[model samples]
Target: MGTSFQDKSALVIGRPSGIARAVVEAALAEGAEVVAAGRDAQKLRDGYGDAVRAETVDVTDDASIQALAARLGPVDHVVTTASARARGLLGDLDRESLLQSFNTKVIGPAMLAKHLSITESFTLFSGVAAFKPAVGYLGVAITNGAADFLTRSLSLEMAPVRVNAISPGVIDTGIWDALGEPGKAEYFEHFRTHNPARRIGTVEDIAQAVVFAMTNRFLTGVTLRVDGGEPLT
Candidate 1:
């Protein structure tokens, strides 16, 4: 609840780029000691260096999540921007893809709540597709929708240890790189023109919202939509 994270310790589980990396930096700037973990230990170590305690864990694996929890002891804040999405149209979807999506974004965080020593707050990552649906995003939709409810359910179970989710819009997180340069540009341009905010979101925009979710004690059980008001227009 306090502005100062001077004495706080945070565990951020995700890759060493974009939203996760931004959150780690933001916490450090606010004077919190951070442990950055992801599936690739080498990448994490290489990216964070001495500035943070870089580690490794596969959120989709229960043992991996538990092992990291035991090793880290207690932490004041827990965050996961980790995501595994299955993007395809209805007929193209497969069971394994759907399961991967759920495990990484929804079930993985659920297991994290069960295993991790969260002393303060647990921040999960959701997505705007849960609100504004479209073709080729059914897998993304169901997984993110579940995560939204998971935030509320965990808030009740975690109680005083605040539980919330950050539902981000189209941030420049390199997730769109799969679309190729021109395609990515076209996608962002569409949002720029149609969305109420009239601009693509930056990682900093998401980081600011995550800080609010962590600092505001009254914000539990909520899914903070940092989506440039896309669902509205």
Candidate 2:
């Protein structure tokens, strides 16, 4: 793909961190007018400076999403990295958490499609956990699986607008920072040994994949896996 977004405009919905922040930076580098939208306008502005138009948007709230869409008008691309983490065993999972997960991953994107007049494409975020199900992350897996199907359905329903999803593995997006340094090292080692790529993923890796999905016209109704061969093993 050509590395130029000269006249393009993009709206990235999620906090200014991890893959979302990298996507904004990548879009800016490619000359696109970008809006880094999230629940916190100040956080977005603080993270991106004047390079992007930071707007407040809570994907879970229909009114908030609609207002942002109205203010921005039409956009060339809409990338939603918004997701809620609901972790627990099947028995331990509560109804509220499960619904919240769906609201964030599945319903939120559906709402975005309903409100936003996306001209080029819409990209949603999923995860490898959906494919390689784990013991305690049943909620995450179910919601991510729904997200994949949502992308496929929207791609057909939305027609020429195009829609796709990206499923990433364990990337060093600071999400693992909560697991102290020692804990992180142990998990990273485990990931390295288990994954076919024998290494962890980076935010840049996933960001590049998002850029590919955004620019490629022929790709739709697909979930591009940006994982380091994690699912393969």
Candidate 3:
């Protein structure tokens, strides 16, 4: 008896991401059958190897999501890694961008909960932005808040189907690399100075929190903060 979820099945939305990739690996190592969904199935295959079942899913599209959900046979746990690149101030953000971000971060996970079996638990992603809104972070804050609230509400409504969120602070995901070296350094420095932990988070840190929530039957409707006490700053 290795673990109860040894042969359990999981669906991880947005498999190529830093957190998502770590989760897939963790789940598989724990004897889980993981379905890695994303826009690029090949990337998932390349990264996770041939053992993973890859699905090219566009979360923003209703039909695409519906079709995938229809085929996800008896999903025990669902974790969504889908997130949009944050953008805009309150005044500068447009409807389409806002909706795109919302649809991915909020609607996508909601739909997954709606369509999937989710017999055990469902985990969604949120961020510290939801709690500590910042300048030019209007969309991110809105979407993040929406996601956390959605999980809490869904947890109540979908009882017995544990639903929760993980709100991680600045993690060392390479997406930050897209911000360029100087930007990355500045961002990390801010987290280092401001966070109680004195360093940014890592993908594995967030993943461990996810595992705890999902495996603990007594927990639900909670937003576990895995930012190493980042908000305490």
Q: What is the C-alpha lDDT of each candidate?
A: 0.92, 0.92, 0.86
Expressed as tens digits, the lDDT of each residue in 192-221 for candidate 1 is 999999999999999999999999978899
Give the clashing residue pairs of candidate 1, or none.
none
lDDT of 3 by residue, 1-233 (tens): 23747868888887576999888877877778889999888998888788789987888887887788788867888889898856777788888898889999999888877776778999999999888888999899989999999999999989988999999988898888988999999989988988889878999998888888778999999999887676666
- How does each model score on TM-score? 0.97, 0.97, 0.94
- List the candidates ranked by TM-score, beginning with the highest: 2, 1, 3
lDDT of 2 by residue, 70-142 (tens): 9999999999999888998889989999999999999999999999999999999989999999999899998
Task: Report the lDDT of model 1 for residue 25.
Answer: 90
Candidate 2 is scored at a TM of 0.97
Best by TM-score: 2
In model 2, how many backbone clashes occur?
0
Better of 2 and 3 by TM-score: 2
RMSD of each: 1.7, 1.3, 1.6
Better of 1 and 3 by TM-score: 1
